[model samples]
Target: MKKISRRDFLAASAAVGAAGVLTACGGSSSTAASTAGSAAASSAAGGKSTDYPTKGISVICPWSAGGGTDSCLRAFCEAMGKNLGVTLTVDNQTGGGGILGHQAIADANTDGYTIGMITFELATYKKLGTSELTWENYAPLCRVNTDAAAITVGAKWAADNGITDLPGFIDYCKAHPGEVQMGGSSNASVWHIAGGYLMSATGIDIQMITYQEGAATAVQNAAGGFIQGVTVSLAEARSFIESGDLICLGVMDEERNPVFPDVPTCKEQGYDITYYTQRGMAAPLGVDDAIMTRLEEACAAAIEDPDFVTFMNNNGQAISYLDAQGYADYLKQAAVDVAAAMDAVGL
Candidate 1:
């Protein structure tokens, strides 16, 4: 397969965005898709008479209820609804590693009433041969959160091995190669990709283990010494870290996370590795530009809301917001980068 550069990918993605708008406008009139397209075009043409969102909107989440994605969306939608003057209901359409919910949002009527929270799994769906959904399938709205990956070890395991920092951990892994067993959510997951990226960048090798149940189980296993380390979001391991059962070696981010300011970043430890799980809201491919703009503006306000900020801080999730265009650019580059990282791990 040919590699697409960030610039080329963005150009092609932008073209896809334009084509999506055209498809929405020309879709069946009997469907909500057509309404979405026409409404957006009408708003763009200076028609300010349409009172958009007279009814509640349904926001789809690809993950199950009670998970990080679902919880974050519920809180965010509440704040967003306050700004938009309408209720935003979140529906958990879980399955197929988040493909079902994403597809539901993509196939829903483009009429701004239905939107979804697209997760990092969107970038891997194609490469993993699970689903063809891409950034092009949805109209980019705005990014809500980004949780950086962290390398954590069992508290006893770290002390026993004398691994006090990233350098020490790398040295240990280099010396003991496949002896260091690392666990994550699953194969080709964001955590797995982060681990793969770390190995490729530092020339260290370790056995990659997958936990089908989720990162929580994997983190628990690590704390119990069933595994030497875990490459999952710090939020997943926050409880264990707080309990002193696990130690965060380093977070894979450009800067240290505020919730865990005592922990050093991979960059600060001399390795420029940064990887994170991004969650954002996106509407179906033909939402009216006006409606989309309104949604984006509302989302921006929701992110700045004190309640939302408090929710994020209390939950240990990082607040990293990116606008529509910026998010589109990010998805384009992320798809390429994720593919490269997956390939490095022979995924």
Candidate 2:
């Protein structure tokens, strides 16, 4: 797989920013994939309309109702509804570790009435042999959020092991390879891949435990000392961390998270490791470019919606907005990263 340097990514992102505008006519969609292997297929084929969205838009969520992805998508739909002048309904089509719902989204009719949230799991589907679906299966609109994984552990476990910080935790893991048990969300999930990335970067082996139920159970188990720690987002384990039951060793981000400024980054601790679970909105292939542009514009405006911003901030999720082309690029690069992680963990 080819590596996308940050400089090159930035250059491409700049190009997308300058190129992606409100103009729907002949707009260049660099990342939006058409069913015929082109960029953001034409309206003459289907869904061409001047008075589009005269009806409600169905937003498919590929996760459970009460999960982080669901909540975020619901709030975003509300904001986007205000922009699009129509109600956006959330339909949870969850199963197969997000494969079933994802397939449903990709297979949905391209009438511009149905769209869905594509998650980080999309990058791992092909490598996991669960599905052939990728970002190319849909027309990406914009990236909504990114939650960085954290190395959080039971406070008691850390104290007893004299692991005061990330360095100490890494030393302990190196000394006791495969003895440490880290509970990531589920098999092939983003947090589980974070564990694999950690091992690949540090040359240390640790047993990765999967919580099929979700990260909540894993965080609870870690707080109760059933496992050593978890590689979940800070929001998933925020309650335990607040109660002093779980100690965050470090966040896997380039800079410190504003919500938890006290916690340092893994790179700051000399491990230059960064991993995140990304969520974004995308329509099925062949949606009209006019409809896609309208949806994309709504997404851009909705990001600034006060209610949505508050919901994201209160929920401890970071808003990392990216346009269609940028998100498409991100998904493409993520496939490479996830494939490498699959190899690292023998997945």
Q: Pick the candidate with the highest TM-score.
A: 2
Residue-wise C-alpha lDDT for candidate 1, range 1-347, written one tens digit per residue: 01111221221221221111100000000111101111221123245434676777888877655446666788898788777777778777765656777899999998889998887777777887888988889888988887777899999988988989999999998898667878766445565555555666677777767653346567778889988878777777777889999999999777877888899998898987766677888999988777887788878999998988998898778777899998888778777766664554455
Whole-model lDDT, model 1: 0.70
Clash pairs of candidate 2? none
* Candidate 2 residue runs with Cα over 4 Å from true position: 1-49, 340-345
Clashing pairs in 1: 40-288
Question: All models: lDDT?
Answer: 0.70, 0.72
Cα deviation of 278, candidate 1, in Å:
2.0
Of candidate 1, the 10-residue stretch with the lowest lDDT total is 20-29
Q: After superposition, how far is residue 40 of candidate 2 from its true place, in Å?
A: 25
